[model samples]
Target chain A: MYHDNYEEDDLAAEVELVTSAQYPQDADVDDGFDSEGVVSSQKQPIAVEIPDTIKNFITYFHRNVLENNIYELHTLYEVTFNKLTDRFYAKQPWPEAELISPLVDDDQVFLTLYRELYYRHIYARLSPSIQDRFHSYENYCDLFNYILNSDFPVNLELPNQWLWDIIDEFIYQFQSFCNCRNRIKNRSEEEIALLRDNPQIWSCYSVLNVLYSLIQKSRINEQLLVNKNGGDMLEAAGEYGSRPLYKMLGYFSIIGLLRVHCLLGDYTLALKMMDNIELNKKALFSRVIPCHVTTYYYVGFSYLMMRRYADAIRAFSTVLTFIQRTKQYHTRSYQFDQIAKKCDQMYALLAMCIALCPTRLDENIHNHLREKYGDQLAKMQKGEDSISVYEDLFQYACPKFISPNGPNFDDPASLSQVNEPYQHHAKIFLSDIHNQTMIPTLRSFLKLYTTMSIDKLAAFLEMDADELRTQLLMFKQRSRQQKWITGNLLEGDIVSTSDLDFCIKQDMIHIAESKVGRRYGDWFLRNITRFQDVIATLEHKN
Target chain B: MAQLAMNRPEVIQSLIDGVDRYNPDNISILEEYLATQCQNEEYDLMANLAALKLYQFNPHLTNDRVIINILAKALTAVPAPDFNLCLYLLTEPMIIDESIKQLTALHQLLEQSRYAKFWETYKSDSAYEQLVSEVRGFSRAIRSIVARVVSMTHQQIASSLLESYLDLSGDDFAAFVKEQNWELKGAIVQIPVNKDNEAKTVVIRENIKFEQLTKVIGYSNEM
Candidate 1:
């Protein structure tokens, strides 16, 4: 009953508020926080003065930043700040940064950080105008410049959560801008001119440069290598990577690139971005749970697009298990609901993958998938007209893919078509599954035979012998995948992923299904732990 | 694994490193790189995709031979998404072109592991030959891929089926089967068991180490 609402399709579609919502450890999970943005005509100008409560809150927030009191800042940023905004500026932008600058004593560094939140709040609640999006992009440049391009690494430190969010939000806004820029039919002439003239703004090249610059400045790759192999961290760190601020930003930037490349439909390049980092409980991305989720989400999606469904299933099941085991620890997190929604989406993705390439999933995860998508799974398996089912789950699970280039401003035809890069991707994926709609049914029939003539099988399936052979070939190809064995994420050896094996001997078809051997080790270990727990309970009672 | 140097031509590398990669003039340099990639087995997917991106924007700059060669190179990088990535960059009209359609027919057959049909359809069209004519050892490369896929799934297969899949016959087929080190016994070819096609039922048993038992031993001593 508690998680039933998370299965709603519209929950995570609004990406702004979740990314904008900061996570604090001891915060309450507020449910009625989804107030849709009420567009008002009078909200354009910086004509309003700062309210006293927000003013004091800004000053206090400024002092904590100055003092580097991350504990207080965490609470203030996640809970108090959002509560205050809901109470005061519900339908409008946070009072302009220039207007609030005096409250923080004209502190440039504090204001830069403040503007990060400021623009994010606008993006979360209000409609960001052309200028707002541009200014937000500028503010990101300023923030990264302060952290990266300083003559000396600035003596500034923020929470690692904030650092990760900065990169996350920067990319989110870039995605938002690209999507917005693609639909210029309603935009005024001035806006069109601005977009045409500022082609460099929010360009894929610029965004990639920023992430790459951070990676180089911090020497994160070298640091990661030193971390993997045996070496001195200080030496591998060089200068910028020594500090936590640069190290984490550079680290987060790698995960950031993993996400960015996925958005641009470069599946191999997406996984290639993870060459330096490993995805395990001990890896650095696991230091932050959201980063951990982000890493696996894109990795699994990329593998899915590449038709490596087994690898995709592995990635999803691992993270979904992690989330399930650690659900209690983060239930009180401000991002509790967001994390739950992501879990639900992953289950949907897992359902699609398992339907296509059936594998024995973890028992708990498999149960959850059946609970969430039982109807769709059955439909997908039966496969008469189930492309819509796959498309629905795909859209519900896949990232918001972005086009790398902007609209052709000179062409009126371009303005007519809004950016739907994900649809292009969906089309590619749907056609692939279309070619294999007969696999599940054919597999069911194939399991009943050790050897049979193609003509006999075709008679059963109501198809000609030639068509059946082609189908068998397709099954053979799809069952073999390039699985990751060891080393970098991209390099892998070809392996048989399917439990079912078949071959053609002239006219007869032979099928030999591999059975998963029953294991006593896991069962014994699980019961042993339960026995120990029961004994401990009895002893404590005595 | 990534530290291994991939062969990249300096002229093409310098151009791709900058905005000059999108120049219509640089298409020739990238085409040369694709030719080199086909002659040898070397591949640089990002470089080739960048070149395709240029042609997607400037349709006039596209060379049919170059597109076909890039797709051919992508075929070798199988199980990776390089081929589909190249397909995504082509213009709508180009994607549906007669030559492109026939070439993709070959791609689909191989991709679907319809090896017999792949060879059947490939030889059915002169355009398919003309398209992949630039790539040397093209049939050999395709056969190797076919062998790689078949070797993973079967310990022994009907030699006739294997020959059909490889598009080879008689002594040529025998030599190809020998190259895989498979034993040709009458109508069957026997492949040695490796990691994948062993098809053995494994009952996993836990192997405890001395280090793990040491702590338990200490507790026993205290008791």
Candidate 2:
């Protein structure tokens, strides 16, 4: 049901009309209108006031019927448009098509555009069968084309501020509808390329405005897989010196963009975005709109994927602290319950990160872990040979930890799909723990002596001297990378002779540096500081 | 005297009137008659009302799947049924009918503690207005579920947040807390753990522990 009037012939006739002498081009007329439509500078700028009827309709719309009531708004637009047209036609016989100035003012046109965009959104959500009969998208396209072809002044602002807001929302919704339809239809690359590459169909400002709107609305999830078409548009905006535009979109948009990257499995890009946000935190978080806890969670998750344990821990800890602080007020609410569940997952992940990092759990956390997972912690501490404990923890925690409030928590298939990455991480943690079993044994052995013979040490460890040496060498390498280790195990000669002496002497064994202990202290202190920072931020805001 | 021929509409009307009067015996007689007249066109609404009356008579009957089964049947009936009652029945935990998957999605949304999403979906879909009107206590049931989950952790919570969460006003929330016998301190609602509830909580924990243990054992056997 799309109207078939927007033919190439019609476009050509419209172009001819604009260039014809009926509309004289003034010196002020700019060629920049070529991309939009033909513009004719007004000889006398008309002070057209929005009629009281349309103004009242707008006020009623803003107060009672907007985003939440689409069908009502649609009906309102139809009735008002007919009434206005009927009144105009009754007052004066319809003028010749070329001589008729715009039937409605800019405010009315903007409302029409808003209603069309809402219809497009509703149509997008409809099933394909019903959508086949719905020409919302085509109708919207035709309206835009009409606006471009007609001599509607493109520069005049709509009368109301709410109208501007609706325009922003409309642009975002239009692009989102197009993007969603493209995916559902699985449009060919050529078709998508035509949509994106064509400056007429897709402009840099439109795409940037949509992106900015999505961020401001805190809808990063919708941004996933949708930004591919806007890639070049974003580049063009940057090239066109749209720094102020980007700034107005603000840091929350950057966080949203970062989350989009994370959802798209581009951890590196997400981390880079996080760095950008961090560099401008004072400007970003200082705004009235505070950063979402989910942003921090995604950032932490991205860092976790990159195996940046310390950063991951910090990010997850921040999320947990934020959740805890907010939960106090609405502890009996479902939102708080969901947040608390998320905090549990974050806590689990933080514990896993600590396990993988060059850190030990502090007494408080260790006790908490023991209480939470008494048997599993005991098994890990005892250096068990079986993988059952780790596997159990992974099995028990991964599904919930991955998506604690996922809709399909009870669906095995969806749960598995959501938990895949978490399971992979769990496996990596398990393997890492398996390899580090020797470190704990070595720590225990070192507690007994400042020095020991290499043969005896190997015997105590139930391994060959070469094997023990290799393990010690791994520890030395790790220590070199992380300064938590105090000293390295240096091999030396016990006697001043030509013969090489291989003995685990005091210097050879080197008092096993309490790296784990030091790391634990550092981690605990950092966590406390982060917790305080979150509390301080929340308290300061209040 | 001729025996009264109880038709489907009369049975439904009687059930409704009985529920209004708290006359369970009259409801029981109507429900028994409804069972024989199940093939009647108006049986779905009648059956749903009967189930709802039973549930209201004893709130603990909310867990009975049989009540849900009757409601689910009513949902699939030919004539237009009271969808609100069907929706309320579907919200009961452990409803397992494939025909009511959309209702199940709503249930799962609530089950997963996505209260905001559930309410948004509920409000956005005008089709649910009938259900919203018919099932008067459904929203309260949802609020109770949320309250139960939240009470598992916190002993006291801000009443203002509770008001917003439950879609109640300040006075209404205070009245609700008082009605529930919960202690109110200024704007804070102190949700006390009932001794009976604590025992039920223990049972739930035990059940979860048993399930996890079985799962672990099953995994070990596979290995």
Candidate 3:
């Protein structure tokens, strides 16, 4: 059956070619050639033999530009455009001029838009030196103007459904690009004024608004919510999977919603959206796209902001595990290498979380940390008093974790700008190690003894008695809920002030047994559970 | 007739009343029916409440994949604080009613690691006789956590102290210790220790000597 269909398709293509050759001028007027110049008269045999150069250009566009190799795409575009333009401008009459004119014009429009979008992606990944060469914001504004003024009618000869799908993806991506530009520029009043003054900007904005409204009107959000309740989650997952265009758009809508919310610092809403995506275990684990790593990364970041350390640890751990597994394959591609490097940031953030909450990293992750930040990690593990170790780890990790350049290089600002959110959180985590863990542990360690002279306790803690007393008094006042310590800090013996009286009076510290100590133990246990859940979720591919 | 309109408060009240009736089958049916109705009407809070009530009535239902689907939906439908009551249902199942003073006290006691006080208060609550099995299971989990915490510091504790902590009698305490494969020395019970062999032996000796010296010094200072 398939062979018969192939034969029929071949015959149709031959007949179409013969007809076009016999009446070339009539063919152009009658066919109303789409942007690609494919004759829409027959659906089965759309393939026509175009020049090899044109074929190469299309292939390069698909392989490099569509595949998100913006760096390579930029180089290829420069070479291809110059080569094609030289051939077109040569003094000799070009034999393929008729065939190539429409193709060139179409390429011009496509390349212009592609270049603008490509630079936006490039701005995210390139170093400052490379970024200075490209004015992405200006290019975007130029493209926006072109799109506003251009009367390029929707080609009736094209597959409208397919075209709309592409448009849908473009709109979604453009919205995200705008969002990043807005964030990266810090939404300056001057930029806002410029956008307001430019009427072309409004046209693009109106189109995005309409597109977004259409997406909302389509009830995709409500459907996603409803799917979580009782509907088949994989239903939408399957529909999106059927076509690349739908798949990209679907994945974008789901991921973009969460990312935008997280970027905006609406962590609660982001968390809620993440919860829905997570429940559709199929959607998360689906091979339609490897969204799990990106999804989990953002989810972890949001959880960190919300102070859900256990969940955050789980999320970051999943991202680390995914990167580790991918590393084992040793693909050595630039994209994979970028992802692996970003995982280093995950490691640093994971370390911060462990320090804050006292969770143990996996032996594998521990080994990885030792391998990367050997002496620093060892000092931290050995319970060194110096804050420099943590500071070094945080500084090393802050840039990578905050604006981790993924394979897509979706957000350009991360490359040049410090991730303010993670930077702020990293500081808090560092301060918390001192305030919440270190001080609390010291006070609880002292409380293990039934009673001890202030001088002796202070001597054991390596601080002056008066200073220790002042610190303890400050801690006591700060934590009004802690009833385990109550006494005059200035003159009396330091004592276990817990109401429950027992006779074991040795002044030995057992960190895991004390009230504050037990909290640390619980935190470790919670992290273990979180790690297990992350492993389970990642492995649950159906 | 007015109730048939299925307004927000009426729907929620109906769910509450259904749960009060103790008819699991009807409650299950109403849960699904009300969920659909609420979703259609965009009464998201009520939908989440109904889902919570369903999970509460048939705690075993959560084991079903479908119930997880409902839970995910419920969590997203409302803000975290609004769903606090439902979250409590999952975490503290035995204390179904927040208004119940005794159960509330039991929760606090367990949370605070006041095991001896908890057992005393639990025994006095004759009104919760029907909840003995559920409360006992919760108590065991809490006792295990306390036991782990206590054993972290002391190798040996007096039998009476262990009994107070575990709410067990002399023979029962000994049996519990035996069941856990721990050693007992007359009036004192030894908690099992699991550590790297070489390090464990070295640390134990050092700790014993240090503790003994500290005790002697403390006595001398007092004298």
Query: Per-residue alpha-carbon lDDT of model 2 for A1-542, expressed as tens digits?
Result: 11223223222233221214453333342222112112222232232333444334444444233243444554454344335435642222122222222322224444445445344322222222112112343444454444334443233222221222233334434333332322313344443344344423333233334444433332222232123234443433432113322233333455544554443334544554443233223433323212345566666665555445555666666555545456555464323544555566656656555544535344554555556656655455455653566566545443211111112323435423322334434543454445555554564575576446667888888998656654553333222211111111111111111011122221144332322123444455456556666876898999
For candidate 2, the docking band is incorrect
Tens digits of lDDT, candidate 3, B102-166:
44454444433455776787687665443333222344544554564455334456677678878
A best-first ranking of the candidates according to their TM-score comes to 1, 3, 2
Is model 3 an incorrect, acceptable, medium or high docking prediction? Answer: incorrect
- lDDT by residue (A185-234, candidate 3, tens digit) is 34444443443344333233344333333333234544455556777645
lDDT, each prediction:
0.76, 0.41, 0.43
DockQ per candidate: 0.27, 0.01, 0.02
Using all chains and alpha carbons, the TM-scores for the candidates as numbered come to 0.85, 0.34, 0.41
State the C-alpha RMSD over the true interface residues for candidate 1, after superposing those residues.
Answer: 4.5
Error of 3 at A31 (Å): 47
Report the lDDT tens digits of candidate 1 across residue range B1-223.
1112266767766776544665677777777777777777667887787788677546557787788888877766554556777776664445678877777677766767778888898898687788878778888878887887776566677788788888898999889888889889999988887654454444434565566555445545654
What tier of docking accuracy does candidate 1 attain? acceptable
Question: Which runs of model 2 end up more than 4 angstroms from their true locations?
Answer: A1-61, A64-249, A263-265, A279-292, A330-334, A358-378, A385-434, A479-508, A512-542, B1-223
- Considering every candidate listed, which one attains the maximal DockQ? 1
* Better lDDT candidate (1, 3): 1
True contacts kept of 1: 0.16
List candidate 3 stretches off by more than 4 Å: A1-55, A59-101, A104-117, A120-229, A232-244, A279-281, A285-290, A328-334, A378-392, A399-434, A437-459, A463-542, B1-223
Query: Chain B TM-score of model 1, please?
Result: 0.81
